[model samples]
Target: MRLRRSPAAVAAAVAALVVALAGTLTGCGTGERAAADGGNERFTLRIGVIGSGNRLTGPVGYLHDRNALVPLLAEAGVADITVHTFPNGPDLNQALVAGELDLATYGDTPALVARGAGQPTRLIAQAQVGMDAGIVAKKQGGPRSLQELAGRRIATQTGSYMHRYLLGALSDAKVTPKEIVHIYSSDVEAALERGDVDAAAVPAANVEALRAKGYPVIDSLAEDHPAYRGTSATVVTDAFLEARPGFVKVWQAAQVEATRRAKANWDDYLSFAVKVGGFPPEIVRRTTLAEQLPDTPFTEEGLTLLEGTKRFLVEQGFVRRDFAIDDWIAPGARG
Candidate 1:
């Protein structure tokens, strides 16, 4: 599908331009100085995530729901924590660029887009890797394969990892759609039922439920297109890292703990995912197990996947420019 910029997209471009200019004037040296001067300051860490309300899925959500992050963050002098949710990653990026969110945990696409647009953020962790996207077709008269999608309308949440997967998968299949509509995840089912679109690219977590409801799965990033699989990125603004110099180490420790607990108590973690993610238990189990959470903040495999994601975004023109993933990663992130 050809890319079109809506009014919201134009506004985002303007915001990105402003951020880029600001970064050019101030540079990284100021942030480094702040880090050295304010190593022990206490503050409230505001985090933006992609989800419904304040609920999230996976290991991060597990820790938040269990109230496990507070103590770990306390070690870094974080007095409080606030979580804000956006419908998609681009919205979360807007919050990050606006300085409303000190940290963000979301899909890799928008995070890379933000970084490429000169948003001062650091990659602190790969919360999950090898995430999958699914393409689901209508129950009746739906396309049977990716090739059948040509000349047909497709729908997906814009700026989502699923959106990236849809574009890549279609490109690989050498299929061009009639149109690609931007729909929210909550509205995808209704749109499909109304025949508003031929097929929809959805998160893997929703594929099983949709299939149970009679939607046909045409293609999946996990099974059919592993190269286009998504990853969840945990990023913090350079300003935030500067102000709380020890934050990355503490946050990494918290992530390690979360991953450990999630694996150790698998059933309890599944129950927690079902409660907060609002997906069926079976779907949650299948999807959660597929998301490979790292014991460390960053793994070699995860970083390689992240680098590939950034490369794809840049090549596809989703990101404005290219950047080295190594330079974007924060100190202490690998641990």
Candidate 2:
């Protein structure tokens, strides 16, 4: 679903792309497509992700668990599909700006940031909203409460929804972004281990790992604080959505199927979670059981969260331009 290539390879491929391939992508309603008349359209749906392991209740995990993305994209006339992983949302946003990805599943913060910066991308669907997130720190000398982090260095992947949540978490305690140092989640764990950063905002997956390593978890949105909620979304380039009218619907179907499967077969879900989240079975069992984590659904709450995130990012100067969140959602694509 993302980057890197040789110039010759890029040019020859772009020169070779047929109108039929183009037709299918734009959902031009042009019928079976000219290229398909001879054979199937040659198309690749590139996806971007922010995880080394596909976990949590998002597109990456659902696709990984069911092996459903390829066949689903194929049904929509795509032949090749790639799922590219990035270290964080900011990195993924770079790929999107360079036009390296056709679609990306990332938090609302990065997606909004990309859009605010003039990336021609549209929110196709909500992957998740209100995912469990929290701040964890080294137990040895870490702060006991959010207030203690006021004058300390706290880290999170920069430009992430979690970063926004960290800002809000601090704001709730009357703390400001200037009070904490921002670092990447990739390096933050090491920083915490070295006692360099006093605390970090992490996904539910890592909270247990840090706690197990004797880090104290100062706060977790698992209890569902308004701004602390996580919002992961399915975004496609504006060009991609224009070409495939109901492409987002197909993706949504895969989400529904994946969620149903996880709920129906919990033991399997736990096994997948353990591997992806890098937590022990007991922790995965307790932390991410079906009851603890809700399935990702497009709803009023998700829309509310999306709107709030956009406004917050602009207010904080995280995104330079202001954009209507609704303008970013694809035509007929639900929240």
TM-score of 2: 0.80
Cα lDDT tens digits for candidate 2, 1-335: 01111211222233234222444334432232323432345576677887774233343475555666567666666675677888767667666545567788878777776676666677877766676777898767778887787667777766777777877777777864323555666566788888887888877767777777778888887574665576777888666565566577777776776767777877877777766766689877766745423354477778887888888877776666788877878877654
What candidate 2 gets wrong by more than 4 Å, as runs, is 1-42, 53-60, 63-66, 176-179, 289-297
Q: For candidate 1, give the lDDT of residue 22.
A: 65
Candidate 2, backbone clash total = 7
* Cα lDDT of model 1 by residue, 1-335, tens digit: 65543323633573555556566323443344345546566667778888877765677678878887777788887777888998777777766765677788888888887787777789998889888879999877889899999999898988778888988899899999999888887788898899998999998877778889999999988999887778889998777776776778888888888899899888998899889878888888888873478787887777787888788878877777688998899976664
Runs in model 1 deviating more than 4 A are: 5-17, 20-41
Residue-level lDDT for 181 in candidate 2: 55
lDDT of 2 at 118: 64
Per-residue error for 88 in candidate 2, Å, reads 1.0
Q: How displaced is residue 212 in candidate 1, in Å?
A: 0.3
